[model samples]
Target: MKFFSRLSIQSKLMLMLLAVSIASILVISYVGYTSGKEAILENIYYQITELRNSRARQVQSYFNYVQNHAITLAEDPTVIEATVSFTDSFNQLENEEVSSNMISELWRFYEKEFIPRLQMNVDGNPTVLSYFPKENIARYLQYHYLVKNPYDVDNKSRLDMAQDGSKYSEIHQNFHKFFRSITTRFDYRNLFLVDSETGNIVYSVHKDTGFATSFKDGPYAYSGAANLFETLQNNRERGAFEVIDFTSFRPSYGQPVAFIGSPIFQQSNLVGILLLQLPVNEINRIMTGNFQWKKDGLGKTGETILVGSDYLMRSQSRFLVENPDTYFKELKKQNISDRIIQRIKENNSPILLQEVKTNSIEKALKGEEGLGILDDYRGVSSLVAYAPLKLSDNLDWVILSKIYVSEAFEPIQIFGKRVLVTSAILVPIVTILSLFLSRRLVMPIYRLISGTKKITSGQSNVVVTVPSDDEFCQLAGAFNKMARTIDEEKEALEEQIRKNDALLLKTLPAPIVKRLKQGEEKIADKFPHVTVLSANIVGFDEQCDLMSAEEAVGLLNDIISAFDDAAQRHDVEKISTVGTSYLAASGLFVPRLDRDKAVIELGLEMLRIVRAFSQEKHLKFEIRIGIYSGEVIGGLLGKQKFIYNLIGNTAKVARFLMIVNSVEGKPNSILISQNLYEPLQEFYQFFKMGEIDIPSQGKMAVWLLSDGSHKK
Candidate 1:
C-alpha cells in the first residue's frame, strides 16, 4: 500500500486498465475461436449428411421406378393377351393350309414397316432374309401391321412365288414387328426380354437402344442372352440389384451404364427378365455436386478438406480444384500429405472418411460408399469431401458424400481473428466502467440472489423483492412469475401423460406401449409372442373369367370379411392380405403358448361359416388355410397409413404351405405347416399327400385335412 503512493493516480489507473484489457482479449479470442469453429463445423456436417441421404434416396427411387415400369410392362395384360393369342395361332397353324400368298405379302409388309426401322443389317447382308428361319424370324417380326397385296413385286419374289405350292410364313415375322412397336412406344431405352422356357433372347431392342445388329446376327445377339440370363438368375435369389460389366455389349450412348434386371412372371411362373440401363452421368452428378471449399483469411494459406460421415468436407484448409488426371499422377508420386495419400490406398466399404494427409487433401474412392477426405490432397490444401458411388443392395446405385476437415473449419479461423481484435479495444473501456459500478451493483444483486435461493428450494409460491431502480429488482420479479408458470406446466404435463398412456395401450402391447409413451420409434423385432394365420380365396382364376372385374373384386372382399370377422372373434391380429389372400397374427398383445390352437380354431370356425354361406348363396368357392405359431417381427410401416405389421420366415412358410397343399384341383381347405403339424398331429385329422414342387423352394411333403377341426 505504501509503494503505490509514489505513482500518480491517472498513471496507475491507465497501466492497470491496459494490463487487464490485454489479458481479457487473449481469453475472449480463444473462446470465440473455439465456439465459432464448432458451430460452423456442425452446420457443414449437417449439410453433408443431408446431401448424402438425399442423393442415395434419389438414386434408389430412380432405379426402383425404372425397374417397376419394366416389371409392369412384362406383366401387362396386353402382353399376356398377345402371347396367348399367338399361342392360339400356333394351334391353328397345325390345321389350315397356311396362306403362302397373303402371309408372304404380310411378311413383306413387316420387312418394310418394322425390319428397316431397326437401322441394322439383318445379317451383314441387308437383302438376305434366308439367314433367319425358325425362332428368330418369328420373334423379330411380331409387331408389324401391314396391308397385303399379292401383286407386289417384293412380296411376289420374296415369298417363293415361283413355287405356287409355297406357304406364306408371315405370322412369325409380323408378330415380331408388333412387339417392337409396342416397346418403342413405351419409351424404354434398352428393353430386353428373354424366353424363360427356351433360354432365347426373344425381344432385343435393336435401334439406338439395343445392339447395333439385328437378332439374325446369331453371335452378336446370342452373346447378350447368356449375360442377361446370369443377371436374372443371380437377382432372383438375392431379390435385389446386382451390378455387372457392360463392356462386352456396350450401349449406344456414352460410357456403358449400369443395368437392373427383374424376372417377368406369368401367373406364378417366371417368364424372363425385363431389363433397363441407367445413365452413368446422373450418378456422377450426385457424387460430385455438393462439395464445399472456401479460401482462408490469408490467400496464401488455405484449409484443405475431407468429407466426413455426413459427406461434408472436414478440413482446416481451403479447397483448390485440380485436374483429375494430374491429381492421379500426384497421388502416384506420393507428393501429397500422408493423410490424403493414405485414404486413396485404403478405399473399401460403401462409404468411409479418413484424414490421410497432413497438409494436402486426399480421399479414398472405394465402391460408392467409404470415408475419404478432400481437406488436403497432393501438397495443395483444399476443402475435399470424398464419397463413394454405391449401387443399392435392393434398388439403385448410391452416391455418398465425404467432406474434408479443413473446409469444415474455414469460418472458424476467419471469425476468430475478428473476435480477437474486437476484444482488445472493448476490454479496456469495460474494465474502467466495471470498477466504478461494482460496489453500487453488489447491494441489489445480493437481494436477488437471496430471493432466487428461496424459489430454488421448492418454494413455488415464493415472491422476490429488490431495489426498485436497479436491473436486479426487475430480474427478481421475473423469477417469481416464472416459478408460478412452471408449477402450472407440471400439472398440465401430468394430465397429458394420462391421456397418452390410454391411447398408447389401445394401439400397442404393454412394453411397446411404454416405449411409445417415451416417444420411441416402434421396433419390428421386439414382440415376445405372436400367432399367424393365412387364408386364400378358392379358385381365384375362375372368377377372373366368370364374373365382371368389379364383381370378382367384390366377392374377394366379401370372402376376406368372413376371415376378418373370425380373426376379431378369436382375438387374433390381422396383419395384411395380398390379392385374394388374408394374413393375420396373434400373441404380440398377449403371449399364449397355445397360439396354434387359437389359429386352428379360428380357421375351423371361418371354414364352417364360408361353407354355409357358399351353400346358401349357391356359390362354388372354398378357402384354403395355413397356420403357424412363432415369434413375429412387428412395426409401423409408413408415416401416412401406419400399418402395424408382422413379419418373419414363419409367416412365409405358412403362406407357402397354403399354396402347395391347397388341394389344387379340389375344393379348398386348411393345411398346417410342418411346424404347426408337429405339435397338433395327434389332435387333427390330416392325410399325408406325397410331395409337391414350389417356386424357389424345390419340394416339401404336405398334407390335407379331412376336417378343419383340431383339438390341443
Candidate 2:
C-alpha cells in the first residue's frame, strides 16, 4: 500500500484511467447482452400471446355461430315436419318383420367393412350381439342403409333412398338431401334428429350406426350426442340449447367428438332434439393452422394445444401428428407407461388420451393466464403461454401456445458469445489508450482554458480549434456550436414575446387578454340583461362518419365561418363552437339596446345559411336554434390555455332547449324562452308551446317560430 502511494502523479493518473476504462467496458458489455436477451424473450412471449389470443377468438366465434345456427335449425319448418314424419314412420316399422336374409346381410356388411376399421382403433373385441337392434325398425333401416348402400362412408349421406320397401325409407328419401347439405356446408361431422318423446335418434345425415338407435339404451347410449339430448330432455323448455364436450363416441368408432343441440318444439310440445356433431378438424385447424405450423410463424418446435378441464388434450398434438416415433420415444423417457403409448398409436391421435399435468396447463385450467417456462408433456423445457377459453359454459377448456427453450433462445446464446469476444478485445485497447491519453492531456487543457475565457467575455460566434481528431478535438467542436446557439436564442426570445400577445387576442376577447396582462388572477363579470342563441347542425356528426377528415373539416370551416359573418351583421358576438353546436351572445361582450331582437335574428339567419349549405353540397343538414334572454356570468378559465366561456342558468337553458323540444320537434326549427318571446311577439310570428319542467330551473314557457308572415 505504501509503495502504491509513493508513485508519481502521472503514473497515478494513468493507472486510474486504465482501471476505469476496462471496468466500464465489462459492465456495459454485460448489461447490453442481458438487455438484448430480455428483449428477445419478451418478443417471443408477445408473439405467443397474440397467436394464442387470435386462435381462441376464432374458436369462440365458430361456436357462437354454431350455437345460434342450431337454434335456427331447430325452429325451421322443414326440420319440424320431418322430425314428426320420421318418428311416426319409425314407430310403424316396429310391427314389421325382419327376415333372416336381411339380418344376415347386414351382419355380413359389418364384418366385412366396419369391423376392420373399428377393430384397428378400439381396445376390446367387437360385439355383434349388443349392436344388433332388438326392434325390427332399426334392423330394417340398417340392412338397407348399411348393407345395400353402394356409397362409401364419406358419401353415405348422398344415398338418398334404399330399396328397403318400408315407410321409413320413403321418409328418409324425402328429407335426406336437405339434412345432408347442412353437414357439408358447416363442416359438421354429422347431423341428427332425436325423438324427444321416445329418446331415439330417428334420423342421421351420414346413416351411421346411431341412425334409428335409441339414445335411451342403444349401443351409443352414453355417446356425445346422447348426452346432449339428455341435457335438453331434462330441461324441456323452448329455446333450450345444450352442448357436450369431446368424448370417445362409439358411433364414430371411438374417436373424439363433440355435439351441440337445441330442443324442437311444435305448438308448445317438445317434439325432438336437433343435434349436430362438432368436427374435431375445425378446432384443430384453428389452433394448429390446419397443420401448417411453420407457415404461421410457430417455427420448428412451436405449436398450440388445447386442454380440457380434465387435463386431456382436446386437439391434436403437433409432435404426435408430425412424428409419432419421436413423440413416443420422449414420452417413454418421461416414464409414461407403454400401454398408453400403444393406445395412442392405435387411435392415431393424442386427443382425449394425451394427459397434460404440467404446471402451465394446471394454472390455465384454474383460470390463471400468463407466460412461464416449464416441462411440457414431452418432458422438455419449453416456453409456454396459457389462457382459459370462453367458448362455452359447457366447455371449460384452456389453450396453450408453446415453443422449445433451445429453439426460442438460440439467438440469445449467440449474442452472449459475441459480446464476450468483443469485451475481451476492448480491454487491451483501453489499456493502450491510457498510455497515449495521459501524455497528450496537458496540451488540450491550455487551449480549452483560452476558449473558456473568450466565452466569459460575452463574445458571440466564438470558435475553439484542436488540431487532432481525438476526444479533445470533439470537445472543441461542441464549444463552437454552443456559442453560436446562445446568440441565435437571444434574438428568437425577443420576437416570440410579440407574437404571443397577438395569438392570445384571437382566442379570447381583447378585454379579457388586457386584464390578464394587467396581472388579474381571476376575471369574471355578470350582466343582468343578456341574450344567448345556441344552435346545433343536426346531421353534422352523422355526416362526418361518412366523409374523410379533410372533407369533414372543410365542411365545418365553411359553415362556422358563415355563422361568424351573420353574427357580426346582427350585432352579436361569437362565444364558442363545440362539435356540432355553435353559441353566440348579445349584450355580454358589448351591450346593445336591441339585444333580444338581434340574437333572435342571428338564430333565424343561421337557419337560412344551413339550408343553402345543404342544397349546394347535396347533404342533409339543418339547424335547430334555442334563444334565451336572461342574466349570465362570463369568466376567464385555465392558466396555460385561457378560454372565454359563459356559465349561468341562461347559457345552460339555451343549450338544452335546442336539442330537446325544438319547434315541431323537427330540424330547421327555432325555440325561444318566454323572456325573449314577450318582447318580440308583436314584431315576429310566434306560437305558444306549452311549458316544460326544465331540470334545475322549474317550469318555463317557450314559443316556436311560426312560418306566417311576421308583423316586422
Candidate 3:
C-alpha cells in the first residue's frame, strides 16, 4: 500500500483501472464461453432433429402415396372386371391336362434357370417343388407364363399372350399390358391378383415360381403374400391397406421384400386382392436420400437410419455402405452373431439383417421423438435425433438422424481453442484501453468539477479543458451553455436522433442502419442461412378498379400495416413490398435456430391476415404465399433512394412459387419447398403437392401448408 502511494496519480489510476478491467473481462469471458457452449449444443440438437423429422415425413409420405394409389387401382373398373374374368378362367382350368413334354420342359426350366439365380442369392438350397404352383390349373398357368414364355425371368411380364387357345390367354392378353405398365412406371417388383375366395394367386405381372400358387395350401404358404391375404380377410374396412414388413421373400430368391395389399371390392363385394411388391430400392432411396447424405447437411460420420420395432435396421447404414471395415470392426466389438454379420456382409446391406440396439433406438421404437447424446448401435457416442414413423402401427419403424459426438462437437472444441487464444491476446489490449481511458476520461471530470467550484466562489475566466475527441470534448466546448440548459438540450438531441432512427428503420433493418451510421459505405452482408417468403395478393387490382384512388391506397395500407405487424410478431424482417407482392426474410439482423420455422409461420400468418381483411372489409381479395431457404446478398442498391434488398435465387424461387400457387392452388395457399419442409415437418402439417419445375432451378417438390399450424 505504501509503494502504491509513492506512484504518481496517472500511474495509480492506471493500476486500479487495469485491475478492474482485467477482472471484468475475465468474468465476462468465462460466462460468455459457458453460455456459448450451451447455445452451440442447442443449435446442433435442432439441426439433427430437423433432419430426423424430415426423413420420417419422407417415409410416411411415400407409404401414404403408395397406399392411396393401391386403393385407387383396387377400385378401378378395369381391375374389377379383370379380377372377375381371370378368377373364373383360372378356376375353369382346374382339370386341364398338360402333355408329358410340357411337364419335362417345366422341370428343366426350374432346375437350370431358376435355381441357379435363386442359389446365387440365398445360402441354403431351396427345392423347386416347395415353390411350385399346386393343382392342374396352377401348373397349366405357370407353364404358359413361366416355362413357355419367350422373355427371360426379368422380362417375362412382356408376354401378354400364351397362344394356347384358352379363355385365360385372352384374359391375360387384355389386361397384361396395364398391369405391366404399373410395375414399370412405379418401379414395383411385381403385381399380383389373388382370388379372395380360395386365396389363390391367379395372376402375376412378373411371373416367378410363386405365380399361380395358392396362398392357402401352396408349398410357400407362409409367405408375405399369404400374410397379406389373411390380413385383408380380417379387416374389411373401406380403404384398408395391410402392409407386411420386410422379410426374406423366397420367390424373389431370399432377397428382402415388403408387401402392400388392398382388398379389391366390386360393388361392395370382395372379389380379389390387389397386391404390390414394395420395392426395397425405393424405400432405401428415400431413407438414404439416394446416398447423398452430405447434401442433406449431415456432416462426416453422420447418417440417417430406419429401424423396425424388432430392433433390426430397415435402412442401410452409411458406414457399412461406404466404409465396411470400420462398420464391421465396431459390430465385432459388440459381440453380435458372426453369422448375422457375415450374412450382412455377403448381401452388402443391413436392412432386416443388422440389429440396432441402443437407448435412442429403444426410445424411438416406443414412439418417442427427441434428441440426445447417447451411445448408438455401434456403441459409439453419438448426437442423435430419433422419431417413430407415422405410417402404420404394424410397421412401427423408427428413424434416427445421428452423427458421431466428436464430429458434432468439433465446432465447439474449435471455439474453445479460439477463446483461449483470444483471452491471451485480450489481456494486453485491455491494459492499454484501461490506461488510456483512465488518463483521458477521469482527469477531465475531476478538473471540470474543480473549475465549477472556483466559479461558485465568484471567480472569473476559469475554464476546464479536455483535449481528447469524444462526447466529453463537446461537453467541454459548450461548458458554460451546457450548465444552464444541459437537460433540455440533451432531450432535444435525443428526440431528433430517435426520429431519424425510426425513419431509417422503416426502410432498412436495424443492423444495416447501424452499419451505415458507423461509416460503412456501400453497406452489404452475405447471409448464408436465411429463409425468404414471397406473397402475392390476388384480385386486389380488380377490387381497386372499382374503388377510388384514395380508398384503394387506404386498403393497401391497412393490409401492409397488418403484414408488418405479423412479421414483427413472427420474428421476420420485412424486405420490400411491390404492388401486390410482399417480401420478407428471417435470420438477417439476428441469427435464429428456427429461421425456417419463423418464416413459415410468418407466411401462414400473412395468409390469415389477408383472409380476415377480405372478410372484415367485404373485399373479394385472395392471397398465395410461398417460401424458400438459401444464401442471399443483402445491400443497398440505389444511391439516394436505396433500401436494404435481398438478391438471390432464393427470392426468385419464392416469387415463382407464389405466382404458381396463386394460379393453381386455393384462394389462400401457403406452399413451402422441400428445403423448408424438411426442417419443419415435426412442427407443421404438410400435404405433398407434387413437383414444380422452375425456369432456372429445375424441378422441386412442393408441399402445401395444412390447417395453418406451424408451431408445436
Worst 10 residues of 3 by lDDT: 481-490
What lDDT score belongs to each candidate, Candidate 1 first?
Answer: 0.51, 0.83, 0.83
lDDT, model 3: 0.83
TM-score of structure candidate 1: 0.35
Per-residue C-alpha lDDT of model 3 across residues 604-679, encoded as one tens digit per residue: 7787888888998798998898888888888887887767788878878888888888887777878888888887
Model 2 stretches astray by more than 4 angstroms: 1-22, 294-296, 424-712
Name the runs in model 3 displaced over 4 angstroms. 1-33, 116-124, 236-238, 420-712
* Superposition error at 505 for model 2 (Å): 99
User: What TM-score fits each model?
Assistant: 0.35, 0.58, 0.55
User: Residue 580 in candidate 3 has what lDDT?
Assistant: 89
Q: What lDDT, from 0 to 1, does candidate 1 have?
A: 0.51
Looking at model 2, the pairs that clash are none
The clash number for model 1 is: 89
* Candidate topping TM-score: 2
> Which model is ahead, 1 or 2, in terms of lDDT?
2
- The window of 10 residues in a row where model 1 has the poorest summed lDDT is 157-166
